[model samples]
Target: MNSETTNPKHGALPPWNVDELPAPLPFSLRNALRTIGPGAILLVGAIGMGEWIAGPLFVVQHGRSVLWIATLAFVLQSLLNLEAVRYTLYTGEPVLTGFMRMRPGSKVWGFFYALAGFAQLGMPAAAAGCAGVAFAMLQGRAPTDGDASMVTWITVAIVLVSAVVLASGKKVERLLERLSWMMILFIFSFLLWVNFTFVPLKDWISTSAGFLSFGSIPENVDFVMLAVFAALAGSGGIGNLAIANWFRDKGFGMASKTGNMGGVWSTEQTLAPVGRVFPINAENLKRWRDWWRYAIIDQSGLWMLGCIVGMFLMTNLAASLFQPGMQVSGVAAGVFQAAEMRKLWEGFWYLALMNGFWILFSTTLTNVDVLARVVADMAWAGGAVPKKMPVGRLYGLLLLGFTVIACFGAFLGDAKLLLMILGATAAPITAFSALQILRLNTTLLPPELRPPLWRKIALVLTALFYGAISVAMFHQIFSR
Candidate 1:
């Protein structure tokens, strides 16, 4: 393969040298494991409050019949996420940056995208708030009744600590990448162990059937059902778009050529151009094919696998431990679930409780960083910010601003309400992203690099699936 490197003199730091036709290393399962960073980070951000809080809430109330939603949603989101990574691999641009370059004007789309993102500001705040509640419960305090001020203060403290960690140095991304894998190995594994050990065989069989069988939504749908459906259909919220930035930062495939944004404390920053198109050729095509295979292993093995397993295990746990019509709310769902486990094994409750706390706290950290990176990227790409503005400064500003906003949201102290609001706003954006990916793959990408007919059809169906959910959600809102 012919390799071409370019070191353009621009920005505060040296530009990343572009490596056209950079050869992909020979793929192996072992190498795949070593390269699994970005997707695991995505999983860490994706699982968060939605999978743990909203997902289990649905199963606990609505039964395993709703798990089909999670299964179908996972398949659709996998397709969507893979396609987003495809754009990043070819053009060395983040997905939102690519979306900004689409259509009449990048600025116009960026505006709407930013607005959609703003609506999701409540997510991290809500998650941090839930984490505080979980932490309080572990300390023998009632999350709902005892020491209300303690939960609020704990929530604020979590957000502040996350910001400090993110701003610590340029190594923030690597730290989070490692942290995500550790959570997967320990916290996630513990949850799965509890599910298998406690969940009855009958509940397991029923949940499996619910996953495999095409189940119908009950005629009488409520706001809770709508919220869970939207949240479980994809990663929690706007955080899904941030995966492209994570992949770029991790130097995955062609993204290695692009300049990465520095951490909040970094002195120098580089703003990579969004639409720096590369020409297609035989050598480039070969490299693209190899990179595509690498992308599959990165996403399928880590991101999708973690989300599917985590969601399934949590849902089964909820279904087995709680009866239908039980009025569980917020982080309390986890507390109650853990308390139930105490009956089976000594000290199991503490394990479950700690796992629950980590789930929310880790997700809070990931969400804060992802949101800051994505917003900074969007602003820079769309020319909303001055060219000379340091990426790290913008990232810190956005991170702190969002954290402040989230503290107010935490004061509301209702995790389910916050999730419902986030879900409703996210549905349309999810559909928009799916549609944009389809458009980009077909119109912008070269024929050789374009998705195959089957894949294109799947993208179309994915768009329609989310579109239908969005429409139904809006209709429900209006009718009520």
Candidate 2:
């Protein structure tokens, strides 16, 4: 593709660039392990916010019974994630771009989702969570009013540093994949050691039962907290949608033909504003089946499986360590857990805090990428912005703006309030996108490529579940 082809005439949008499908790498446990990445990234991002902070907080307050909410959300989101990736496998575009390709055109959906994505993830809650952990590590105690200014500055620095690290990478997606794997290994290893060494078998059994303990709600329960936990128990809102962006960049399925977003300073690759869709044929269909199998393993085996284990382990540790009916919430909740670990051994305290730091920091870094990637793709594809501009350049600008906004947002409240705001805002967006994904996949893809009946039903249920959560959240807010 020439510069002329890459750059559309001033205001004109480029047409969809159609192409033949490339054969997927054969599906095998080995091949799938090598091929899989997006799910790992998603899993790392999913680990911190809900599993570390929200999940344990809920268990501490409500006991393990309500964990069924997280279980259900995880199952639904796995299906939601696979369905979103389904669109990208057929058309080498992020699912958000597919949303732009829907009725009412790009301008309407693009503007709406751009705002929605920001609204959903704009809070630097994860960074704020990191700041609290960092401050505790430094000061040898949790932060308080006198330490507010220091914590706020630390939050800003964390956000700024995330921006620099993201720019330093060769490709945004590749950088995230490497970082996620490293963090996952260290964080999970530390978590497992702590759980096994400190947490007892009976507690683990009790927590496991809590997940299957459906419809167990204590009286005067905080509906708001439960709603937030449910939303974030997996990847939460836009995080689920962002999986498709990572999948596209990973060159899965049709995306193998369409180029991905390059690094901020990279000029080597050029991504088409519109994605290419392959024809429906026997060869393409065969490749599609193989791709579908890989997708299943990526989501179910890696992403969902990781979420289940991560949530279970984190909650079990909290249940065993923290006293039931104790009040704990937000970023401070993690600090509280670290403080408890100190009772077992002083060294365990530092390890626990550092583990908390990595979990939250990884999410903060990934959120930075997701916010920029989704908006940049939407604007570039929508033609709302200059289509000729490199997506990397646009992405860089958005990254700067998102960082600045998050810095200011750090002072708005403590990490807990900010995360609650994050989850509350995210719930509606998740619900809306669920239905859009159902529509987009059903209408845009060929008949043979559309999601089957069971998948379609899951999508509907996902939308309805989140929709109900949104309504309940608002009522809980106003009624209070």
Candidate 3:
């Protein structure tokens, strides 16, 4: 057995490693796509709710001028994500765990991280509630008067079913992975087809230019626009941190050595031991290089591509289909437009409604799962939970707690407002996570494992970019 030291002060475990770990396969398009699982999961969690609701909501109001911001956000987030995974690859610990290791230690930062996480508790609730709106609409309960009784009931039903699915066992990850891909294929393809078939060539051209242009926000920008911008910028919010855990669970790089937290029904209680650092050597260096290459492909190909494409398509569809001065409200706005589009083409309405519902519900599922995982990781890393208590039990408790919060929000009956409030709250958390990840990558890793000078510069800019947006969002909120 390997001898290891545990830092009693901060609950820090010894560095984790395993002999004979899985090596990344040779680089190829096929191989890259095969490694698409984590990033794809990130994509679904990121774009599912925001693109459907905020993308169109913004485009309908501002005419795609703000899309450039969304694109820029994706680019910056990709870098932040790359840096985050780097620490995980080297350490076999979640990125947030790295944050816990910062100056004052896990206990101090874990409190702040947990506090930030509470702000995001509204996200999954808002997502499930939006999906409930779509479900209500599908059942012919028009939200013309903003009555959400049907939506409330449907949201509760979705949360309950999702809880059951999660608690079903250790197989939840695989099940969610498969379900995410199916949703992506069906929803993305349908949106692309609809936009191409219905949206005019000139509108598409104009919107494409808008996406590339750094156009001005309308002088009349309101709380709605600020909220939309915040939502688009952060996209995935605190849940993005979950990407590192997903990478670990997928057995990427060093994470393979650190066993993953089991699913909701798992009875395993004790956390896996954190491995020790591999002594710098030619073989280990080569392994790091191979893992870095794999990380780039996975981050660029899936996370960046999925978010950018999904946002662009959704925005374009909104700009093409809805004229200025039209009232656009959250998921209902998209679903109703699809209903209108169906009048033009038979069988189109179902596709639109399905896409809308799938996006929101899928996000709800992933958000709940990701939050549970993150919190559980924090609990274990911080030594807050007793070793005798099973991880699955903690995960289940948190998941159920979030679902209950969501049910309460659903009954409150304002999906759009609820989502906006949640989105605004997410902006600062995004900035915090980005900044923390940058610090961890720069200071924690060995000089050889640290990102190069150019990436270091880019990471700084990424953190600042998020910081500026977050500050501006708060300014807007307070000024209002």
Name the best candidate (by lDDT): 2
Pick the winner on TM-score between candidates 2 and 3.
2
Please tell me which model should have the higher lDDT, number 1 or number 2.
2
Clashing pairs in 3: 15-274, 15-275, 15-276, 16-274, 16-275, 17-275
Q: What are the C-alpha RMSDs, in order, of all predicted structures?
A: 4.1, 4.2, 3.4
lDDT of 3 by residue, 1-480 (tens): 112212112234443443543567776788867765777777777775577776677768767776787877777778878888888887777888888878787788878877677666544454544455466456654354354565567677777777777777575556677778888898789888988888898888888887787746776766445555645543546766777877777777767766676777677753464533454556777877888788887788777888878877887877777776577544364365565676787576666777777777777777778777788778877789876777667878888887787667666645666666667766667777776776777666666677888787776776676677667777877887
Candidate 1 deviates by what RMSD?
Answer: 4.1
Clashes of each: 0, 0, 6
Off by over 4 Å in 2: 1-15, 329-331
Candidate 1 lDDT trough over 10 residues, lowest sum: 5-14
- Predictions in order: lDDT: 0.71, 0.85, 0.69
Question: What TM-score would every model get versus the actual structure?
Answer: 0.91, 0.95, 0.91
Best to worst by lDDT, what's the order?
2, 1, 3
